[model samples]
Target: MSLTEDAIEKIIGKFGRYQTWILVLICVGRIPTEMQLSNVVFIIPSVNYVCLDEGAFNATNYCPCKYPEYDTSTIVSSVTSTWNLICDRNQLASLAQSMLQVGILAGSLFYGHVSDRYGRKIAVLLSLLSEVVFVAISAVVPEFWIFMVCRFLIGTAVGGTMLCCYVMIIEISGKSFRPYLPGLIELPYSISYASLAVIAYFLRDWRHLQLATSLPWLFVLFYYWLIPESPRWLITTGKRQQAIDLLTYIAKKNNRPTENIESLVIKIEEQSLKENEQRYGTYLDLFKTSKIRVYTLIMALVWMCCSHTFFGINQYIGRLQGNLYLNVILSALILIPGLILVVIGSLYLKRKLSVIISFSVAAISLLVFIIIPSNMENATLAFAFIGQLGAYTSFVQVYLYCSEIFPTMVRNSAMGFASVFARFGGFIAPFVVNIGIEWASITIFSALAFCAALLCLMLPETKDTVLLNTVAQTEKNKVVVNQEST
Candidate 1:
């Protein structure tokens, strides 16, 4: 029925060395992007201002000048001090930070199409090139408006690169190995977050820090020559010759024979035929099917909640208690254990159950904070850290789970479409925290987190299930299961 089974085995070996190297390259590419996303944490200024007009201060015996200069000794210069975005202009700081997420939202939608149409490798390379140029430009922009523009462009590239790299890694690896790969991929992100703290500690000047972050991407520029185009993507796009060439190269590199090339070509052709029969999938396809539509809606809501909570916590990490640098470092470092546990649980526990537990823990931690008096600094800080651990775990698990749930044809498209909502959540998270802290209460986050956990109950368990290539396959798989059980 399918191409000879043995031939398929030889081509798509079980989590071999070649795949491992590809994984490493993709993970490394993620480092600078993650670093830049959080870089604004350090860039936000901590400074005290003094009135510039001596006459106004002298007459009133109170500081009245809104455009006062700042004391730069305690801190190296920042955008806040440099631009005088203080007092009446304070809201601009948060607005600037949110703009990056806006670009990310656009990039995700654009590049997902690029990856599905052109290929993952090209999409990733284009994103990296944009990052290198914009990141460098962002460091030198003389005005805040121009800097914001650069930040937005960089955000676009970061968003696209993140999605393409992740989907490509999952597509290359075996089903049994898929769960573990996300954890490994996340390792670089964690290390980069911690490294940002260290880097910021030494390079206090925002310009210097920006330069440091931008230069590391020079290495990422070479990925065009280093990384391979995803064979799975090529097969979907009807590039059988390209897929065969890549697969043959992979087999050779892994010391396997290519005598099975005929079978592999036949298999690719069979898949392409099925894909053509189904008609082309569009963004609307994600919503047309009832089961998939429900799953998409649920996952989309959870992704938004997870992103909102995760970035919201990051914005406040420095305000928690101890040294700002140490607090940020600990916040990033705390994710390591949570991520490892999620990876392990993806094997033994149900996917839906694990995600629900993770989100519930995060929600409960936030709720606990509302009850504990703010004066009890130690307890509040501990709960905050616990909340971060839960949010980070869920964030990583959702990515892995979505990869399994969506069919190959529309996987990136669905992810990209969903990311549009997630980025909107991120865009609003800072304002929610900032305005909520001033107007209502921070407990609002607790309620949102709880709702996110509840949404998890609606998703199906995908653990140990094969990744279906099309919606028709999913329906067929369901029927086959019913027949087998009876």
Candidate 2:
């Protein structure tokens, strides 16, 4: 069966009232964002453990903590000495956390497709429950391989959750609130990062931390009761009665009554029953359309540059100079202003203008860090701080634009389509830093700057009008927006 433009229009029309103010207030729904943050922080210590590997650096000297155990003491060894079983080395530990991202790169596609097929509520529940189990198991894994496997399983859970929550909020929330609600998920990262630091301060051991982190996922079960099934999805699946009931329930909750909900339901069902039979293509369809191909590829480059630069900069700072925690604190601090600017820019200014200005400024700031002589320690700190801010802002802006521009049907898959480039960036960033900085730090950041500049050329401006309302609409406006000038 062929899908019709009329069906797509009906879907959009059904969502149009979602943008209303009262509806936005009522649907201020939150997913399990904090739980995921705890997991991230739980994993970060191992990621940075190379900072204290083999007891090479005295914790008291650099840390000034005035305590021995405040460090990654040979304590894992101290305890394991009494037992036959042992935790793995630094390499395995780091790889354990990273393996999950590997799992994410692999699983994001199928996870997203499944949600688009069956239902958002079910997908999110399954993802969260599976994550809780795997992450908990990972905390207790005796064998190194089992731990890695569990960690990878947790990654699969994350892939599912990210896609599901995004689709769920947009699909269920009123059209008025979609942009703001989605923006909420990203801007709250500062709070999440701060919470992680505080939690890590209290729970120092990686295993205990992992358990502490995984525990909140149990609370995600609350979502089963609170979060609604996506009405758009119900409509898409031809569950018209369910959709009408859900919509009526929402109307009642907001003090607005649906007078002809029964008639509306019958009419919508009759209209859609013939139209929605066409099976959605695989995630590969993200690249199948000429217009989608351009959109996906450009976003891919932006993802590649942003992830590569961020990771590369972190490694460069960790190895070359500067304090680890200080850099992290500074980076986290920058996120506040970055997020504020994103909210202001995305709402008030042109979305595409923000994207260009963001990437271009990031490129310029990075160049400043590379070219300028930084004899003073504070100067280095200031430069890195400012450069980080620019990069962070650009990163947030790009993600927001991505959410806006893609068609509703393939949004998650389109987002996932950029995963390969983003993952490649993660893979290549450290290598590039290690090799490129042999000549100078300037050379290293210059590479990042260049990628930013080049990627900016491929993006389309999405400041005004509705985003990608139809296939023809998406295809027509896809002339790449140049990042250098406008």
Candidate 3:
């Protein structure tokens, strides 16, 4: 165990009041992030429309009218209807959604460096602040282009907030709690996702729904005072005093003695300095060695697959043959089983096996959905839910698995690197959905899932392993595993 982990174990005894507070704060903060990410489902829902020129309409022939009449029985108003994003302009809706992913892609790359160079606290705070500002702007922007810009900005913040917050949670947690805590972190996501459906149901107007989602983030902004920088990050950055102070505070919070905190922090600093001297910890270091390179490549692929299917299914919810509101709720709620699977996997299953199982389930479920007759709407929906469950499970598992596999020095960067591809997958999801062929989209998702599962077999299982602090340690683990296999 690293000195920081040892000190935390001795001082806080693992899951304690201090860690509990951190978990709750970070997890609660994620609610708004999920809200903003998933709100697109309601913000740009599908609508039936006809040309405003009644004389041009007939049973067999239709005219392309610049002015369109929208049936707003379900959605009072949306970006689609407000701008008449239909017919030739229908691609604009997908573009708006894709813009958010583009922003997130940029943010992931930007914040990965920021989180590592600055501190997790600052990255998270800045991201949250940006999310609040941009989302509110998105709610009120009269011009579609202005709204798209806001969405892109919001996506950037979302990417930063998610990456940094997740790293902070893992850094502060103990070994026993580390794996399971990530699963718990996903609980708020499910809550926010389901709640958004209800919120959108009441507030049919996209702007009102956007405001409802954006407003709750104001409360999360208060986390500035509640959350602290990761002690491990402090130690690695050569901030011994800050690490000592933080560990002392944690010790006091957990009702443990602070007497040895300083000594522990000093020891951790020395070890970190030695490790730092051995190698320059940068994003490039991830691919410096063969084993690490293989791990990085496989992780990137799995993340992309997970995001592709997960977001594709989410974006396609409106097109499903059912009540849109109910479909959204059911889709969000189906994630509960996936979350449960994550918890169970963290405790009993190996990380590699868990990921493989989840991906396989997703692929098989999607294939079943494809085979189901088109007229059997309920059966198809059931299969879709199953597919989503598998995708959601794999998605959350990858987060935990990725964190465990990477060293602390480059953990955030590794996540950021993989997230770049994930965002790319998400960025294309709307375009895939817009293809207007449901079976074709499902085929793509299933193929990706199958490939991801197969690739996962190449990764080393990280369950119950200590989180490494340096690339050298990771390579050492690889050597031991190879020796054992031989």
Candidate 4:
């Protein structure tokens, strides 16, 4: 174990009161992320429309309609209806979602650096503040172009917030607690996901639903005062006193004796210096060693596969045969069992095996969903649910697996770098789902899932392993694992 983990074990123990409190706060804050990402499904739903100008409509079936009447029994006013995004303007709806993914791509890379340099707390706060400001602005924007820009900005903040929160949770907890903690934190995400369906069902109008989701984030901003920076990050950057103070604070809150806290911090500081000869690691360092470079590439591909399939399935839910609200609710509810499977994987299975199993499940289920006849609505929906279950499991597990594989020095950078590919996958998902033939999209998703599972075979397992603090340790661990396999 690294000195920081030892200090946490000795001084704070695992699952302490302070840790539990912060975990709850962080989980609650995560609610908005899902809300923002999935909101597009409802906010720009497909609505039936008729062109007002009969001559132009008759002349060219694809002519732009200045005013189109929309059926509003189900959804009163959405981006589709408000902007007349029908016929020639239909592609704009998908463009709005794509812009959000582009923003996430930018934010993940930007905030990964910021979190590594400025500290996790500041990055998280900035992300929250940005989400609130832009999401609220998005609610009232008159023009579709302006709203698309806001969606982009909101995606950026969501990316940063998610990356920082994930890193902080792993850094603060002990190894024994690491696996289960992600599952717990994701609980609120699932609930928020389901609750959005309920909220949107009542609001009917896109603007009202937007406001309802954005308002709760105002309360989450108080996290600036409540959450603390990671002590491990402090020690790595040569902030010995701050690290000690935070550790002491954790000890007191957990009712652990702090009489030896100073000495423990001193030891941890010296060890950190010895382990990490370089004080700060950069993205370039990720490619310094061959093994690390290979791992980085494989992780990027895995993340891409996971993101593409997960978001693709989410956006495709509306097209499924059923009540849109019920389909979304069922999709969200299915994720709970997937999360439980992650917990089970953490306790009983190797990291590689868990990811492989998840990807295989997704690939097989999606393939089955594709082969089934379209007219069999009940069978198709059941299979779609199963596919989502697998996709979600792989998505969540990849976050945990990625964190464990990379060293602390470049963990956030690595995560951000990998997430760039993930977001890229997300960026294209809307187009794939909306433009492509339904079976083609499912086949593509299934193929990628199978490829991702195969790639996992090349990477080393990280279950029950100590989180390494430096690049040298990362390379060394890979070598050890390779020798053991041989």
lDDT of each: 0.76, 0.56, 0.82, 0.83
Which of 1 and 4 is ahead in lDDT? Answer: 4
Arrange candidates by TM-score, highest first: which order? Answer: 4, 3, 1, 2
- Residue-level error in angstroms, candidate 2, position 80: 14
Instruction: Look at candidate 3 and give me any clashing residue pairs.
Output: none
lDDT of 2 by residue, 1-486 (tens): 112122322333424443243223222222223344224323433222222434447433332222233235412321112111213233443454356666665556666777767776787777767776776776676766776687677767766766566666555543334335434655446655555556655665656666766665576666677666766566656677788888777666555557766665565455444433433434766776786788788888877777666555554554335544445556666678777777777666666666667666666666767655656666766666676666667766666677666755566677666665665665555446545344364455546656665766666655533333233335554443233125
lDDT of 1 by residue, 77-122 (tens): 7877778766567778878778888999999989988887778899
Instruction: Rank candidates by lDDT, best first.
Output: 4, 3, 1, 2
TM-scores for the candidates: 0.92, 0.75, 0.95, 0.95
User: Over the full model, what C-alpha lDDT does candidate 4 score relative to the true structure?
Assistant: 0.83
Whole-model alpha-carbon lDDT for candidate 3: 0.82
**Candidate 3, residues 327-439: lDDT per residue as tens digits?**
98899898977787799888887778888999999999999998999999999999899988888889988999899888888888889989999999999999988876878
Model 1: lDDT to the true structure: 0.76
Model 2 clash tally?
A: 5
Task: Indicate the residue-level lDDT of 119 in model 1.
Answer: 80
Put down candidate 4 lDDT per residue, 241-270, tens digits, no spaces: 898899899989999898887787777667
Clashes of each: 0, 5, 0, 0
Error of 2 at 294 (Å): 2.1
Error of 1 at 98 (Å): 0.6
